[model samples]
Target: MSAATVSSSPKITEKMARESPAEQAQVLVKSRICNPNFIFSIFSNPPDSNYSKLKYIISSSLTEACNNSVLLLGPRGCGKVAILELVLEDLLEEYPDMISVIKLNGLLHCDHNCALKEISRQLCQEHQLLFSKMASFDDNAQFMVSMLRECGLAHKTIIFVLDEFDLFAQGKQLFLYSLLDAMQSVTSQAVVIGISCRLDADQLLEKRVRSRFSHRKLLFLPPSREDTERLLEHILLLPTNSSFPHEYVTAFNVKLLKIFADYKFKEIVDTLSYSDSTVNHLQRFLFSTVSHMDLKSGLLSLENFKAALSTIQRQPKLEVLKDCSILELYILVCMKRLEAKEQELRNFNAIMKEYKSIHDTFQTSNYYARNVCLRAFEHLLQRELISFEDNRGHGQSAEFRPVKLLISRPELYQGLKSYPSCPVSSF
Candidate 1:
């Protein structure tokens, strides 16, 4: 695999030159590495992999037509959800007619009522039943239990995937209790699989709910540095036997290897991994890098990764502050000034007082009206530039609620530098 082979291939060069930008992109898309579906094959379950362990548990329960429950715990990007999906996908293929799956997320269906409504909705969709919102809590509960019984009678195994499982443990734990209790009945054959980022997720369950659970937990951790490097190579290196010309594939892989060995590229990867070393973060980074590929620059280089790193690492809060009105910037500056003075329990009221002090001291002509400043404060809150302290009661007025600036000093400096109409002399 040498650069000379690529340059010597006149046929390949001619074909590339003749192809339009869209046509070249289509060619690139044909590469197995460039396609998401094809890429997942590289991540499929191995003989002794975690994928196999999970598949064994879920598949055995489905085969026996028995109720079972297990929890998957890992930090974000550890492939907890991905592995489950892969296992379930293969299992569903093996027992398509006998298996059904329902997915619920903690972020969306955290509340018991909302979760029940969503479960009813999903069950209705899956079974082709006309879904109607039941009028009472008892009616909805009965309906769900009846649906489970119906599925069980028909020998269909229902698999429930609860994402952010810890959130479902909130409140009265009614959802968790009801689902687990239903699993206990002889008429129900269902498997509950919970996925959570928290390692102590199992400890969060109520005593009753925990008693019904199978006490099986699978933990996932982020890949080590070596594994991450291997993943990068696996994703970027073109297949030798792919549709592309042999010379092009070799040349592309060679360039990719060189880029991987570069210290600058390693630095970029380190910077990304320092904050978030998850597969999800790597996916986003790669997606950005790959988007820069084109007919002219068909092969990736160190520059592409550097550019992608810059784009991904940008602070969105700074961008939002740059677009803010002058009054809003003034409020933020006041907060920064108050922070510098080591003031304690600063809130909207304190910010206003600080602003007045500055206004009177400087006699600034652009002093925004008090009502306008109030509106600006509200706008800042909405933008998440400032957040109210959690210890403050909900009934407390907004003006008196202790607040903190979300942006750092460096970000503040950067944003002010970019604001074209910043009143430098007034401050």
Candidate 2:
């Protein structure tokens, strides 16, 4: 028998497929670490729809391993990846002897043949299969498919996971089609879960690939504003170092904790809300929040989250973005939506067109006066946030280029989540 595959986290583990019960238990001991950074530990009872789905999926995966083929769809930073990690961990524990897993990222193997060969390589290496040393790509892939099927028929399980799944759709869905197609004839079952960040990824799938699982999917929508607050609140209230032996402690600082305790829900949302940020990304950002602040008897202030956000995205100083005002953010949003290239000199007329279109769409009559807009544009130039071909003059209507876009469109969208209630929303 084979064993577990590659791992992203130390907690989601695999034991030798045919190892003794004692040996398998030993392999899983690593999961007992008490550090809160282990995301699989923090995944306990999240306040969202994923809990039920995870319960069902974990149960079904243990019961019917091979036949599970899930397509997880969501945007960046969402907890889509974490959800899968939990599922894999559960399956590993439930079917130590029967299950063996391999996870690969779509971005790593954009080519279909490369993707297959890589998957085959990982499986072979872990299982000590003869295909590990095989030279021919076609021969190795076929052997892998056969071995996976044979395992299923033998009442053993094989799980294949592809992250960044959209990238793997390149080769006519060759890798996906081959792996999934083989699962049908096998008796026990095998699973192939593909995860993608693209919203339109399903539409890009070829009919054959789509037909592999008859169009099965798991959509991971962005968290609602209320859910975002709950998530942050949960993180804020997570056990600190002295909070006792919680399996996973939330990363909190004394300074930050005090503010969270005192801030109203609306007040918290006004400060900490980030657009397009998922639990995964937020968790990562949260991990670094303590490092950004001073740790003293004084509790952390809400103002510190601004530094964390700026640091997370490698953006310019938060003050640079703060100086630009909401209308400035709207201008950045317009430019980004229009796909303004960094290399090209953007024309003022083009930007105004986008701004006009945005106002018409959102039905807002709150555009800044042309003079105010031009001054804002000139101010951006003075701050070195943007550039113009004629660097000598404040030519508002001329073509200009963004030199230091402190906040990107996606980040701006995130910032806009608390808009209108925003500091400069009044103007």
Candidate 3:
């Protein structure tokens, strides 16, 4: 066959045209070198402020120990991993010859053991030739110790960044304990940086492991509204432009940006891109739902907008709630109820009573109460709407209090005031 005849195909041209605009845009964007301006612009001035309080915690921990282990605690998309990457970048620039960084995200694996094995495998691959002599150590601990020795001697420091570290700790606590013990023996020249979304005080770290990382507990505060807005502006603005169209940016639409911006910069971008792909999903809902009416009204008062939101809230598919879990729903209800009362639910018992009243209104059976409440409380704590003041015992019976309930769905609050009991079921 002639090369020209084979190359000139109408089918291929048609296929290219059929590709989505967003996908085509992505392909074009990915084909070019990443724009440094775009990357840097997403970050605000005094760059440290963009990081919230985490920047200080990370810097303080690194300054304290040449061989430190830090547990960054926050919910998913809260930017624990991004901050670590930024720290790694800084470390590499400051001590290129002395530092060797390895980052492993635990969520990629099937379980904690698999995550550990993957990390070990990656470490082996990276420094295979250097640790060729210590190949006899078959177990992970021995292997890690041998690798640490090689790294310590060859480089001044070695940092292992474990993102989603909770995945590894969930069922494989013993394995983590062993890993931490092994890392502790690294001649004061190695460190481990662990990141996780949940920070159960009792389960945050094993007692022995906790002792090792006590001084390095870095809590990442959620980004402020102002910081979130600035971050969103950076995200929406193209590198070529200093500002985006005002029509494309507004307070009502800004909540989506704020929600995603609460996470790390990279995560915010990933979520935004995902939201863009399903743009119609939200847009459809907006038009068919309250947002559509609110837009038409032209005077989007907070109260009216909230009322519209309440109507739309009831119509969400059950599948979405299932994916979010009963506990998540329970927490959502608690937040709504508290907002309805126009008083912050500070006391643990008081919050529980409010939750129980809603549960009773829903007629949740006795068998379901404990499990449902536990799940809801845990989810709320994970999302930073509430926190555990004390854990009377291990596992599910722990007591918790609202640290601060950041409820964005103001409409749900208003709706609950009229029908407090089982407001979810009422509409």
Give the candidate number with the greatest lDDT.
1
Q: Count the backbone clashes (under 3 Å) in each candidate.
A: 0, 8, 4
lDDT tens string, model 1, 1-427?
1111221111346787677543443355434333433334445535656677888888888778899989999998778887787677677777889888889999999888888788888888988989887546666677889988998999998899999999999878999998898788898989999999999999999999999999999888877798788778766666565446677777778888998988988888887786678877787788777776654656887888877775776579878987899888889889989898999969888988988887888787778777888889999999999988786478888888889999876567668877888865232
Better of 2 and 3 by lDDT: 2
Model 1 ranges with Cα > 4 A deviation:
1-41, 315-427
The parts of candidate 3 lying over 4 Å away from their true place are: 1-65, 107-116, 128-138, 186-188, 201-203, 238-339, 342-427
Comparing 1 and 3 by TM-score, which wins? 1
Best by TM-score: 1
TM-score of predicted model 3?
0.48
Task: Estimate TM-scores for all models.
Answer: 0.67, 0.63, 0.48
Report how far off residue 394 is in candidate 1 (Å): 21
Off by over 4 Å in 2: 1-48, 61-66, 132-134, 238-258, 261-269, 274-276, 292-426
Compared with the true structure, the alpha-carbon lDDT of candidate 2 equals 0.59
Ranking by TM-score: 1, 2, 3
Candidate numbers sorted by lDDT from highest down: 1, 2, 3
